[model samples]
Target: MNDVLFRTGGHAARITLNRPRALNSLTHDMVLRIDAKLTEWEHDPAVGTVVITGEGERGLCAGGDIRAIHDDARDGDGRASAAFWRDEYRLNARIAHYPKPYVAVMDGIVMGGGVGVSAHGSVRVVTERSAIAMPETGIGFVPDVGGTHLLARAPGELGTRLALTGARIGAADAILCGLADHYVPSAALGDFVADLAERPVREALARHVRQAPPGVLAGRREWIDSCFAADTVEDIVQRLLDHGGPEAREAAETLLTRSPTAVKVTLAAVRRARGLGALERVLDQEYRVSCACLGSPDLVEGIRAQVVDKDRAPRWSPATLGEVADADVERFFTPLGDRELGLAGDGPLTAPGTAGPGAGR
Candidate 1:
């Protein structure tokens, strides 16, 4: 079956993530197809906007197809996974700079790769059912797909807290964190999309916009800022532990559950991303970190325990924050000599005026 469906209606070109059974996890082919379509629509005068959503009630997208990636990393000499990320990151950059309004109906679980596609859109709409997160730390990977960029820019230390803990937030919190633009009830999403097909994109969205209830994150801002304000993951954990409250204890414990190396690397990535001026630069940095982790023992082991084995007990190398040396973390941020992520216009993955790989067939 087709993993994605695309059609044109009225002034809008619509795309649907069709892998409902898998929570619409993105694949290489799907990413290439979406990028090609977006590139086409970017120049088409008839296409005033683009709208994307998932096919099912479960999720817009859970993440990249990590299980497939795990297999690729094991058998394909990492070439397949590397190519997938390159194309996916390029697609993310395209969506961020698309000439026309890009609308994302982030109605359900939007995590990892899902965030890459939807949260970066110009018009991100979330519903009460939306459970947005960047949970890469739990799987021993730093947040990628420009996730560090979004998380780094979140209010105060909220981004740091979210990055470390892999916490899922509702629509209100998503909006507060700058991950979403508007909130509409899930029931009203269909009507909103219908309106988009007939009216101007902004007008349709404005008509459906409703005030989101205050998110739990807003109330915890003081705690988040105070606990996560430190420069290192170790210091953040110490602060949380020393604060001596249920929230603090829970936050610390959550951090403890993630791969120690991942926590440290994620902290460093987020801090670096704060000073970045462009999304492309942030993506470049993330790609570097991603390639570094691709062959690391922790990434493979973490995936095995949590995904392949389903044991829920990943024995992370450098099992504690103290064991993860500064040099170990720095290597993840270093430039990738020949394999650097090329972010120049059109990039190395797709050429201008030519169909992207997997575009037509």
Candidate 2:
């Protein structure tokens, strides 16, 4: 079977990830297939909505196939890697702006690229087994896949914390943090998909659910707001060091272990993209940052230590947090000219403030 499957049933177009072994890790081809299907369905009169799910119980998607990315980077032809990101980012923009209802079964692992596909959907269902995270920091990359946009909208420094630490949150936390909408048991996904296949009854199914998922960081808002209120990464770290609790302290430690240059540039990028730019524009900015990641010192070294060598210690450029220069960090936002990803001036897929549930929150 194809790694990614696209079909039409009833009023909804069904897209399924067929990879179970790798937890449905999305490769570049899978992304292309998904985009092609979405394009085809856009104009198809028979299809009314779209539902995305995975083949196995392990995850909707673990993330992109980073191993392939690492190898492409190793070969010095970062062009292919860049193309993958460009197309993937475009797909994310399409989904975010898609006109019809987009439903996602966010059971099991949903992280990194998976968030781009599922989080922005009109109906995002999480289960007890849901494990959501933006773990790009662990691999020496900023959280792309439109995660920066979501992070930008998160309350206060909570966005910064998730972007930097690569921490995982359960179903309850995913809802509280605005990453997911509804909560349902994983076992119910089959019936849910079956229902979607028969007709457009999402409103009715939503009302039939039992107790909702718990909130992951409910009471920590005050602390998250206070600690992340700093102007810069260093300032935030200092704030955490001064008065944060165990959660804040541990998050601080995670940041310290990441590439200093990457952490700084990522934080700055997230903050800048918050209000001034829309989702696609911010994704374009992320494209520039990702392209530069190949030429930069942090990405390769990070992959070597974390993925290849398995040493768990990356020697970041400038070596320490204090050495990252403001100018150096600014280069990430610089335009790539012809290499840039462009979008038309027409309206987005969804209305400005109506993308999915709790959009722009």
Instruction: List candidate 2 stretches off by more than 4 Å.
Output: 344-361
Residue 353's lDDT in candidate 1: 52
Candidate number of the best lDDT: 1
Where does candidate 1 clash, by residue pair?
none
lDDT of 2 by residue, 52-156 (tens): 998887899988887777877877689888999988998888887776778888989998889989997767888989899998866778889889888888776
* Local accuracy of candidate 1 as per-residue lDDT tens digits, 1-361: 9999999989989999999999999999999999989888878989887899999899899999998777776666888888999999988887776667788999989999999999888889999999999999998888999999999999999999888899999999999998998999999998999888899876887788899877898888888899899988888888999989898899999999999999999999999999985788899999999988887778777778888999999989888888999999999988887798868433443345543211211
Q: lDDT of each prediction vs. the true structure?
A: 0.88, 0.81
Shift of residue 149 alpha carbon in model 1, Å = 0.6
| TM-score to native of every candidate shown | 0.94, 0.92
